[model samples]
Target: MTAKRRRFVRDNGLTLAFGMAFLLALTGQAFAGHAEFNNELAADGLAPIGLAAYLASSEFAVDVTENWQSEYLQFFLFILGTVWLLQRGSPESKEIDEAGPESDKEQRVGQYARADSPHWARTRDWRQTVYSRSLGLLMGGLFLLSWFAQAVAGSAAYNEQRLRQLQRPMGWGEYVLGADFWSRSLQNWQSELLAVASMAIFSVYLRQRGSPESKPVGTPHGATGVES
Candidate 1:
């Protein structure tokens, strides 16, 4: 590879790795989902859909968005919760004394900003305020968007299945309030919350020698938010 290409890969190795993993997993889901969907069609005496058709179906959209919404919700809550909540001995939290958005001087914004600070960090206006909380805003926005997508696509998919089973199709509002929607949503949500809880609590006692996610092996358990 070229020198510039090597440098780019080194700089963004983590994102690249996960992006590739996401693609692989998505591909696997598409194929497996298609097969399962076709099996349902066969049982119902309906024609099976092609791979392209299955990929574009509301069933696929609902499945994807259901998980997406939950994942975003996890990060959304984590980002906002960490502002005021501190977990002693957990590397995922702030030091107990640092619970809230700290002073401007500590954050190096406005007059206290260094020469190399981001442009918004040096500005003293609404723009700076908005930029400061942008990460949490983005996570919350994505969660809402994906959750709405799940509701819409899930309603359509559920109604289609209802029709196939000789049952009455439901309106969007009724479908959204039904057990199907809540089951799909809550199942994904419970798992995400558990994973986040595990990460925060596990880091307190775990030691991953060089990983930034864990505290240094020699650090005391009482240390909070100290990345290696």
Candidate 2:
């Protein structure tokens, strides 16, 4: 009922809505994935798996993990790259003069930190040191974790296929070095890079109306977030 409570609800409502939407979409994908996987099993003369079993299978794990790795890699690269790079008119990038990590004052750390700033910002110690690089660090770590998950799951999926054909199942090392693994990784990686590049370049000339991703419609093409 109070202003603070109303502000909190409004600020967090979008995040909650999107989180539920993402979960629903993922659940739908899992069901569709299970059905398709079972169809493949039938074609190969293998017993069809139930939804629970299919979800537990390496096929689902590998598919999910491969996509996750690509997403994390994209974020990791974007966060790190934007520090040194400038897109003249894009909302996603800082202006040319504001390049690099910028001063501690600009980042609102230590003496410049506000009363409600994060504890790490006030600590002035190792916590602040790590928190300063936390965004890129977390993204990089998640990328590695997702990549490893993909490798492990892919190996299991690959072995299952080999066994179905009465061929010898491969060891993890062999599977990691195989064409299938690299192909899956490269395909996703290329698409992610393409999307990021397109967003960076397109935002220079495009206007998305009220969307934060674009400058205001009336703004000059050379103008940046200042126009928004």
In model 2, the runs with Cα more than 4 Å from the true position are 1-9, 225-227
Clashing residue pairs for model 1: none
Candidate 1 regions with alpha-carbon error over 4 angstroms: none
* Best model number under lDDT: 1
The TM-score obtained by model 2 is 0.92
What digit string (tens of lDDT, one per residue) describes model 1 on residues 1-228? 999999999999999999999999999999999999999999999999999999999999999999999999999999999999888999899999999999999999999999999999899999799889989999999999999999999999998999999999999999888999999999999999999999999899988999998999999999997998
Error of 2 at 198 (Å): 0.7
lDDT per residue (tens digit) for residues 1-228 in model 2:
999988997899989888899899889989999999989899998889899898899999999999999999999999999998988888888887888998989999988889999989977889989999999999999999999999999999989988888999999999999998999999999999999999988888888888867888887778754446
Compute the lDDT of residue 149 as modeled in candidate 2. Answer: 99
RMSD of each: 0.9, 2.2
> Cα lDDT for residue 133, model 2?
90
